[model samples]
Target: MKLNILSGLIAAALLVSGAARAATQLITEEEAKLPPPKGAVATDRRGILRGPKVEFVSPGDSVSSPMRLQLKFESFGGAKIDPESVKVIFLRTPNVDLTPRVKPFVQADGINMQDAELPPGDYTMRVDIKDSDGRPGTAIFTLKVAPK
Candidate 1:
């Protein structure tokens, strides 16, 4: 189904912020290390979780300057999952800093994100999404704001 234009913008933002889990939100990696996509992973291991697809869409290396962008998310390939169950989050972690900037965007059925504007900078992003049945999926992304 075709979603609203802002929906695309939100998806792009989520994509840019890969650290944000697809439908789940958390700060420390410890939480991220847990089993994901609900029933998809019966065991806990450090790797990709299977479920909804999340992608970062802007402020890429190609960017020459600071700009405001949105994160994007899409659901598919799961076993009869509901978009409403998905959760979206954006976490900013720096290289030297042990603590990451944690930001919760939104949670909804199909897609979730924020309308806030951000300046240029390098940030480690995370997106988390969980199915209604408890399945969880998360994605990691990097955003480099270049001299545009």
Candidate 2:
């Protein structure tokens, strides 16, 4: 019984370490300083299937580093959200693609990032998602991170 308990404890430790290793830098300080690309337009258009609704659930307009970032996606017209179609873009000069970094936390309902590390600054992010019907939706918001 003692050996079994030890094995379980070891397995738990490995899982925690693996999760820590999977954490990616959401945005770097240098990358955030880049100027926005010329004519970089981010627009939302209505579709026949009705786009999904994206909601920012935490870390309001202002927050600190290593914060929890949660977003909820709501679909309409009997359509479901397509997790694979999610896109996260940091609205900066030559926009930074954050989709890959946040992919692990994405789901059909939304994204729940437990540890989003960012430098102190004002940042704007554009979240784009599509429904199972192929209808697109987008949400743009600004986040201000206070200096530590």
Candidate 3:
């Protein structure tokens, strides 16, 4: 009887450890299946909790020198967003090398904004936003930068 109880305790401990690891694993955009056509904002709901709803705020399709861009994320389905977890990447841009750029400034209310003095050209950027619980959302937009 003692041996059986010891075996059962070991099994329970292993199960609990596995559950903890699963809960801390971060979910990626592809795994979450959150792509919503180009230039469209989308929310990911594949995780245990729903992600934020992303929206574009500034810098229309056409822009000029001293480009300023803004992306706003709101909690969807009562999810809490982690503003510091926001990230923006320059997917493609003419006459520019894709290097490590400065991180965008995140607001207290889940708004990430960046300002850059770019040359005359076109650019495409991707934004990734996530919640405090590891749920992620993504957005892609293009900018036609013209000479000011």
Candidate 4:
């Protein structure tokens, strides 16, 4: 019994180590193609938005429950973004009518920040923004939260 347990532990360790190495390798490959500092465009299921580089900083690409998601974005266009037109809401749930728990605010530097605490569930967080000229764009970020 002791030998079997020892072998299982070793196998588990090896599996975990291999998975970590694979993840690290993927990150390095993605880092090479990261968008430029300025004039970056985010394109996802909701179409494309020129300029206004969007970056999801928190809750990471994937997260567990009881997580706080953070977003930071910049606008590089002719018209100023309408603060009232900024919204973050859930997607693909019929009759859910759920919106982000936290209200987003724009900093003086023209960057928009949104943070929200979420429960355990799969979420499609979609952010919509429109400029004063009524030019609109949407950014989609996927979140998976495991039950804690």
Candidate 5:
């Protein structure tokens, strides 16, 4: 029994360490390349607007409650878009244009959230992508964050 218990503990450790995990093809900002899905878009008084293709997948790309509304962006022409020039907004109020945001990461990809953390109710996610000159570009999407 002691040996069996020790063996189970060791297996759990390996799984959590990600050592036993196989290589995963990270969805690059480019491969995140899927045409933006539906969601909300808007601009704040500061004049920041979200891209048209902004979207979400899963928080951490896994199954869980209170799942995160991820954001996806793409620029096929004119000016190329990157993550830094983007922003996310989550709110409880409606019809009011506000700056939705998080700490913009230099190396962050699409947004995500587990299912449990987000409370059930009406919610909205907004995304904005900026041009090279630091002006808002043309892109937008909107979606309702509700019960799973």
Candidate 6:
């Protein structure tokens, strides 16, 4: 009985350690080193329908890894934000689609990622969102991760 209990405790500890490692690997080193896309113009065109606005709420220009990432979303003209229409893209040569990884934390109000982990480097990201009326919106931001 004692041996069984000891093995169970060791397994549980290993699982917890694996989870922590996974949480800190949002972007891989190879992916982060890709070349920038050519003619990448981060512009948002406003049409008759107003688009949703995205604003970063924390970790100003530079921050360390394993930080909380908060973004606020606002919709205008009586239109509600469609959470399902949100897409996150890492602006690189072949834009890395981060939607799948971040879909769990996305909401109509905003995106609140509790533990966002990335390597020490400069990263650029683009967020695209649409309102219920199909009005599209885009926001581009940069995050500088300081070395540990």
Q: Write the per-residue lDDT of candidate 1 for residues 1-148, one digit (tens) a residue.
A: 3577789989898887874433332233343343333232222324535555556665446443324345565555555344444433334211222112223333343322332223344445555655544556666665554433
Candidate 5 residue spans exceeding 4 A from truth? 1-64, 93-116, 137-148
Better of 1 and 5 by TM-score: 5
Model 3, range 35-141, lDDT digits (tens) per residue? 32355344345553456667878787777656565667777666677766766665521212222343435663544334455556655566677776677877666
Poorly placed runs, candidate 4 (over 4 Å): 1-53, 95-100, 104-115
Q: Estimate each model's TM-score.
A: 0.40, 0.82, 0.55, 0.51, 0.41, 0.82
Model 3 scores a TM of: 0.55
Model 4, residue 40: C-alpha shift (Å):
25
Residue 147 lDDT (model 2): 80
lDDT of 6 at 88: 88
Candidate with more favorable, higher lDDT: 1 or 2: 2
- TM-score, candidate 1, is 0.40
**Tens-digit lDDT track for model 6 on 14-39?**
99988865563557788899988888
Tell me how candidate 4 scores on lDDT: 0.51
Candidate 2 vs candidate 6, lDDT winner: 2
lDDT (CA) per prediction: 0.44, 0.86, 0.57, 0.51, 0.42, 0.84
- By TM-score, how accurate is candidate 2? 0.82
Q: Distance from true position, residue 82, model 6, in Å?
A: 0.6
